[model samples]
Target: MGESDPFIQRVQDVMNAPPLMVEEKESIQHTAEKMVDQQASSIVVVNEKQRLHGIITEKDLVQRVIAADKKTGTAADIMSASPYTISRRAYYYEAMSSFLMNGIKHLPVVNEDSTSQVVGMITLSDLLKKQNRGKFDVLREIEASSSESLADVKFAIYEVLGHLIDDGIPILHIMKVVTNLYDRLIRHCTELALEEVKEEIGSPPCDFAFFLMGSGGRHEQFMMTDQDHFLVYEEPAKEEDRQTNDAYFKKLGEQIVYWLETAGYKRCDGNMMASAPGWRGTIDHWEDRIRTWGLRATNENILLGQNFLAFRWIYGSEKVRDQFVRGVSRQLGKSKIFLRRAAELEKNVPVPVLDHPIRALFRVKKEGMDIKKQALFPFHHSLQILSAEHGILGETPEEMIEHLKEKRVLDEPFADELLYAYEVVLHIRVTQSWDRYKLEEENSSEVSFRQMKSRDKEALIQALKAIRSLQTKAVATFGMA
Candidate 1:
């Protein structure tokens, strides 16, 4: 049931040999005739350059053109614009899930080459013919459920983790799936919370955005992760409006946090949640605060800047997030002192190893080694400092590393080595968290090194060495040492 299952095969493996494609401007009648001639149920619509544009299905023709009696319409008019497409590299289960989610029978498969051109087509019939009804059926159920609580989805996520881990998938890719699903869950929670808030106190007084910071924002999160959120709304014009907006947003934040806890996502122990008054405010106020942090560059302020550098919008208006991001970027451009302080903060924090005999390499406690503070944070903070120095802002560590590579701030080989090292640390941390999750332990970052295999311990040692190299690079870059 693991790797032998045909359902786990790539979508391209089961897709039709050649995709039936039609130009977007082709007449609906012409498209229909082409489909009929080819015995195809759907036609992928492409642009002049042969890139994916949309799709035209037989159902779309009958419903939109025939039903409306618009016989003269073109495929562009009747086709579903920007239709959901699966990558040729994606698994059959993912394509199947996409089909269920979009309620579409035919899926256009696109290659990941330079043009992202259409390659083939897959259908519900094709997937059903080979897919195992076991795990894939469970995924479909979890997706289609209407339950308010995330308990069901949480279990489903764990099931997916087990399958992926057992299948020998790379840790980096596994964590990507984990974080993506969790982000979607958080967005759904926000949607539900907003609905309740609207019902109770009427519509929001202004536009607002919800953001994730720390590990979740960095997309470095795995099992046993907690919530670290930020909330910002449009400035109110009047005192009365301000009062109402504050109350509405505060209630919304509290409700969402409560729901997240109920669904097993723990609240941040440091009180960094949006429910805290310090973390929720108008967009201008948040911008001013970020500006102040950059100008001051104090030890405390530098810590705050480090955390805020990981900010990513989870839900709400992109404009709001973009404004804040631009402000941060501008501030970084002008604040060399702040960048220097951030570089200084990259120094390691020595957390004592509690149970493990090998205290030199890792900081272990009751749960185990402090993977985050010792391993992840050193590399993360170093990259952030370098990014700020170059006036580059990245949402994830990988992005930051790539930017550094592209900017020639770090040699390609060194950047590549750092990336590999980061992945090694992240993979071990995620696997450890999965183990703790099986024991129903509280969300924690520490892992016991005594339990690890010799090869894994060796890998951890190598990663720590890579982090030290990065730290030296940061010091030299910022003249901090």
Candidate 2:
């Protein structure tokens, strides 16, 4: 592509057309000088062949070196390694999507011919400036405000979503942006809770991990659904210490829940919030609970394990989360009967459509088709069972698919097909949920077949078939068929 290419206003047109190069071994001071000389916000570290090594941004320098009072280090010492990169041929929207998905400011534009060759750099700020200002402004407002302003920002989000839908952006992409925003909102609430707790009780008595379960855990959540979370903390050494720690963490968890509810997040109906005593516990207690659940092999236990295992840490210590994951995996792996019982749970999810086209068209729409209960559940539930049996806890559906494929638990074309089907179903749910929001109704997977376009109906029917196929494989693999 030449400088005067027709797509002059595109990302390809402006992305480091000449390329800014820096050696990985160069001193931070030297890199700083180069950035200043070029009037650039970021400097790309590259080797002799122009292969990208990492990137050093102004934020990285301020946070890692300057804020930490470190005066000496190579660019490699502070640069963000294995940074997100885009091809020079990619469009500006693709670059913007990457920025939102990865939560990164700067991205290196690489050569299309050779992926490793860095050609230019782009920032989210630059891309946003070039794009339409309306939706981007909503994102900016949400990011800049905290709980005090979340309600107003949410109003803006609704407007943004309507605009995006009207513009015909894909449902999956819209959900991705919405999910990212929710993650940020959760973090902001957590921060506020932490500060309040600190003021009440000098400091945390011990390390703890706060995590979300269910859709939020899987990174698939779109709307402001009910929240499900739990807490895991290090076991205290003495009786008095244990009591002190419990009191502090319990109060902290309550504060978080309260703040989240205040910010419009509905509390979990199952009482799975960290504020609940059952969901807040020492690491040893959590391990014991998992061991008991595995031994019981009961329906409720399996359901509980299903929700708990699909968790993502939001705050506090990583070690606590890691230890809990290993413990749950070990306990579940030791029980063969538990795996089979869990796999059998898929039989409970009713198949809402048939493979035969005419029969599918005649499919009943009682309370509409629950995309979650009837479509996504079979796949998510079955995968959760397989993951538990294989001791593969804490993986998203996509990650689980890859792991299962690698283990020969599922084969090629089938795996790809299933992943695609999963994406389609998720997209349908988001679109349906958006429709509900537009009607000022509750968001749910239950969208009427009558409401869908002919193509959407076809896609939904195909998704049902895919779920059925996976359910068959799941039961057979676990000796439940």
Candidate 3:
């Protein structure tokens, strides 16, 4: 049905009234009580013409009033003047995203002339009604695992995207949500590792660091992303010499990886795990690896090594993550060779494009789309190459876009537009994979974006095209890629 359907129309009619507007000069105590009595979380602050000026919520009442030891006068002082808002023509689905993401209870709907006459308020609960859920096999395993497997976590992660897709969640917000979950999973895994293995390290709490790279780095990881990761450490001066520190870091790697695999992330196909002495390095050792990996860029072995680029501190000391990030920055300044190699590797992975004459758009069937080999990976590699060149280590495509744009590689409008495309592809991939897996039509190793609906297929293909264009622009600017 169109957005004007009876269901939406009724919801709008009832929800259309602006919160009981109290003028900006209204007393805090009076407004707070009015809000409570009206069963509202917030009230609009408006000028006499009813145009939106600001807002105050329950949070303001507590944080500004009670916690700060302020009386009724202070609550309104804490109100937000710059809240996110939407226009009247916006679809209910559009508000769904703003509600959950912007963390607002009410969106002051304004008219064309910019009068915030309190046309509507969209509650989080209002949008939750549209959410759809799909059963995931991995959730059962995640709960059951004694040591959370990265593999199970990966699948569980997949289900999150599936949930968003089935519920018709906006694609852009879904990307953010999924990336946030990926980040959270690694963090939780790190916490689990820290708790399980800290005594072995024996220093104070702040001695180690975790690195999540590749798909995890780009924040665009899909359901089937393999664990391509590494671990690095610093010399624990408190523990005396290098050997003791080395042993401690080594054991930490074994423990973390054991749990990761047992939990579900398959060991890296290249075996570049922290368990590998080559990958589990002290600061000097890591410096050597980065330099060598860059210098020896042509070797197939090191070419495969770029997958390790998805580094983030999942556990250990913030100092370690910070130090390593700094080292990366300095080291990356010299990595033109490595960035070039990454671009060469991308050529091996052909992006599926539309059979359309323009070739500007990807032509995809409603069958199996190689969202990975074609659209996802090429864009990922190009972005990675660009990110490394600029010494920016963004954990996801969305992050990369921001950093890239800030550095002048991509303009703001295009960055946003391309990210939107990338999200649509992810949403489709997760939904299709979930349904196929549900029916036992397929399992591991075969899920892809080919199963998307036609309209979705067109959009996804179009998105791939946009990413490809952005990547091309990035390559030209960076020159080496």
Candidate 4:
């Protein structure tokens, strides 16, 4: 009893066997080369029945024949006669330690009968990546969400990202998925807020547009972005209409923001909150405001263009948002005057750039520039303006890219790359936010280009450079495209 293997449970826990693989009769050299190409350390040797044969690994290559200056042509002469075997019924720890202690990467697993064909193979790296603390909490929350528990749904959003942290899923893909759920959660909160106050808000078709700006608008929101949004309703023609529900919508918007903050998103710092009167306006008023924003270029508009083009709708009727889009778009396309103004505003928006010459001449600014401002902002805002000009309606930057691509303004490859870059930027932002918030660093809202890790920093810089290169080409050919 005392001598029994402690790893039996672990090996049995993770199912293992073999993969759909090439047969053993295949050229040994071909199989060994394929193994190296797949980044697999060893090849699972099998016959037509898919029964395990002696395995061939790097060790076999170096120690047995390759090192002896023998050609890797024949499997029979070079392959080891007896390969180590572990029952599929064994535990993960046993398989893992066997792989680790023996320095083998691939292990063929068999059945409890000790003679069944090979099943699945387990890798140490994959097993480690899948290990996490909140795995069960996340699964439980998913179940709860299926049961219509809003609280669990809210908790799931936070838990998913946290579990991602624990599981070491690449930050990029995790952020892309997180971005999806964040919008869903925010929309859920908006509906809940409206339901809570609907009794007090009599129907006026007083349609409201939920305007999300900055990272939220870009679908690039990190873990830290508060919902920087606004609410717009059609101006009431009647005095009674005006007097009754204005305060109620204001209160409702505030409650929605409050609920979102409680759920996880912090409040916007610039007081760009939907609760603010400056951000809350009627449909007609919003139209006029958007026109003014398009026609008149100002320092504030450029200072905040990163946030401005990031503007979009998170919830409410798409028709209402559609109408707003029409107003904004028609004005943009019809008036070359306004279009030119918009184009000028685009140039007005400065991005992070390192003068390669200047950096060589002198030291580069330690922080570089805000990558969002320099890289993501240009592409993000250009798409927004382009959409408004093209009469394309979209609630998020991802939507805008799709819309433009459908219009043939964007090629699939370039659009795909842009979206990939945007996701990577969001990944970088989330990590930066988490670190800053934890360290109590100032300006967590803006992630500095320098804060990125060496690989990430280089990748982002390359992304920014590519974006600028493309932007220049587009500008030269299309003129404000």
**Which candidate achieves the best lDDT against the true structure?**
1
The window of 10 residues in a row where model 4 has the poorest summed lDDT is: 1-10
* Residue 195 accuracy (lDDT) in model 2: 85
Ranking by lDDT: 1, 2, 3, 4
Per-residue accuracy of model 1 over 208-238 as CA lDDT, tens digit each: 8899888888887665467788898888888
The residue-level lDDT of candidate 2 at 383 comes to: 80
Tens-digit lDDT track for model 3 on 315-411? 5667877888888777767766767666666554546555453323324343454666566667766777778777777356677788888988778
TM-score of model 3 vs. true structure: 0.64
lDDT of 4 by residue, 295-380 (tens): 66565654444365567677776777877767656655554455455456556554545435433523544655565556666776
Task: List per-prediction Cα lDDT, in the order shown.
Answer: 0.77, 0.76, 0.63, 0.61
Clashes of each: 3, 1, 31, 16
**In model 4, what lDDT does residue 62 have?**
82
* Backbone clashes (count) for model 2: 1
Of 3 and 4, the candidate ranking higher by lDDT: 3
User: CA shift at 428, candidate 2, in angstroms?
Assistant: 2.9
Q: Once superposed on the true structure, which residue ranges of model 2 sit more than 4 Å away at CA?
A: 1-19, 23-120, 132-134, 237-240, 348-350, 359-368, 442-444
- Candidate 1 residue spans exceeding 4 A from truth: 1-17, 47-53, 65-73, 87-94, 111-117, 137-149, 236-244, 295-299, 348-369, 439-444
Error of 2 at 9 (Å): 14
TM-score of each: 0.85, 0.79, 0.64, 0.58
